[model samples]
Target: MTQRADVVVVGGGQSGLAAGYHLRRLGVDFVVLDAQSAPGGAWQHTWDSLRLFSPAAHSSLPGRLMPAQQGETYPDAGHVVDYLSDYEKRYELPVQHGAQAQAVRRDGGRFRVETEAGDWSARAVVSATGTWSRPFLPAVPGQDVFTGRRLHTVAYRRPADFAGQRVVVVGGGNSGAQIAADLALAGDVTVTWATQRPPRFLPDDIDGRTLFDVATARRRALDAGRSDTGGVASLGDIVAVPPVRAARDAGLLHAKPMFTRLTATGVQWADGSRSDADAIIWCTGFRPALAHLAPLGLRGPRGHIPTAGTRAVAEPRLHLLGYGDWTGPASATLIGVGRPARDAARDIAQQLSS
Candidate 1:
């Protein structure tokens, strides 16, 4: 028999856990399904040397302080995982690790979730799976023909691995810049940052506060209708670290034109320039992975699950927490989704009670 719960939270990260906590507090029975064996989502897969730009004071889940003392430089990726593990233990949240949700469909008034573990039926569902489900690697022609090592930024850990090699760091995001700089120091790195827009960088801190605070303020402004809410492409408001600028100043980094295609030995740029490299690291970013529910007509033109203001457009019983542009202060962060979780949980509880 399929297990039944009042609500099923699909994901065991902070957002899902927060949703589960709220459900339990409201006397709503729920279960959390996570694909990973641990609570941290993408953090568990992050580069080993990665650390948060935001300090510990701002890098916290709702109702729980970050273990690091206030003003401490943001925790490393490992520290994040440890903190998340502690959070899960402290809450005693009903999370089933290694439960990969394959499909979600509405059955009558309830939603049926099919996963690797088993089937679960719930009156409401929380799709807390963040937006980075699928890495958005650019599809370049002859990409497979490349004769060098190619890896996505998600899999890249340390630059020491690429020592003494000519590296081509593609993409112009923060990850691209940081990785390219690190590699340049380690070896003869030629970072071909393919981007149409001019790059902008931010300081590590502004007035003793992190740039994440600025982002949070911008989010609040967008929500308060006092500012223009732009898409992810408009990252001017987002702070880029100073190290990126220093890398450029050190003559180790240079911007390359947009990508045209991949050749057997290297990459070709739109400006008719080509460069050979020992390896390529694609930091193109990621997209939502809802392929399991291809039948669900809930995706936007951009392939993101079209959310009707956080609630799923096609399935009201189904809700999403971190799948949009203005994900509030914590949209993609562990701290950002807490407020959204409370809002979603309240809506789900009201829907169930009524």
Candidate 2:
């Protein structure tokens, strides 16, 4: 027999947890299906040195604050993982670990959530399955023939393994800058930062918290049907973290335009300049992890399912959360995801109650 709930939250990451929090408050019967064996979600898999761009107070969920760390402005990955585990226990949210949702299909007016453990029949389904599982790598000419070690940001753990090598870090995002800085600081590797366009750096005073506020203003402006006049920073711009700022002072933040193609030994620039590299790190970002939702026939171009806010446009009973800004303004961030999760929970509660 299939288990039943009024709402089934797929992916017990920050977004899923947030959704569960609001649903519990609304007295909605729900269960969170998490693929991992323990708490922390994707934070458990990130690099050892990875730190949030915002302080603990600003990077929190709906009901609780992420406890601040001593002598640390931004908490590290392990700190976040510990906090998430504690948060789940503190709230006593019903989250089933190691229950990977394989497929979600419409069953008459309800939805069937098929997982490795068992099937769950839910009145509504909220997919908070984030993008960590799906790391994207862009195709460059002769990439297949390149013999050097290549890795995506998801697989990267630390810089110790990259010592005494020529490494090319690709992409203009925060991950790219941080990784490149890591390699440069390793003291034995030659690092080259490459991007399709020059990277935009946020002012030294700007951080993720400020970026979130900027995003909120933009969102409010859009909702009010007015152009955003706030000269807020773009979230994509690189934050001047301590390590990154130090690297800049050491003259390691210089970046070159993206190469035209990959050679067997390294990369070739548009001007025919060749840089020999022992490894390449691609920080090209990710696509939404929506493969399980394929059975619903909701995926459109670019691996995105069209949505009215977080609700699926074609299937009103389904909601996609925490993938990116497309679902909600800054929905992929810890501070930004709560708004959408709360709204989604409210909608699901209303639908089930009605």
Q: What TM-score do all the candidates reach, one by one? A: 0.88, 0.97
Q: Supply every candidate's count of residue pairs whose N, Cα or C atoms clash at under 3 angstroms.
A: 2, 0
lDDT of 2 by residue, 267-324 (tens): 9999999999999999999988998898999888787999988999999899999998
Off by over 4 Å in 1: 69-72, 188-191, 204-238, 242-249, 326-330
lDDT of 2 at 95: 98
Worst 10 residues of 1 by lDDT: 203-212
RMSD of 2: 1.4
Residue 86 in candidate 1, Cα distance off native in Å: 0.4
Deviation of model 2 at 7, angstroms: 0.7
Alpha carbon deviation, residue 221, candidate 2 (Å): 1.1
Best by lDDT: 2
As for candidate 2, its clashing pairs are none
C-alpha positional error of residue 139 in candidate 1 after TM-score superposition, expressed in Å: 2.3
Q: Model 2, clash count?
A: 0
C-alpha-based local distance difference test score of model 2: 0.90
Q: Give per-residue CA lDDT, model 1, range 1-354, as digits (tens).
A: 699998898888767777877777778889999998867877888775566766666777776787783444656777887878888888888889999999988788777899999999888888877755688777788788999998888889887787777677777667777777767655554555655555555443441144444556666677778865443334452244444555777887776766687788887877777877788888888886666555566776777766655687767887887654433454666666677777787888899989
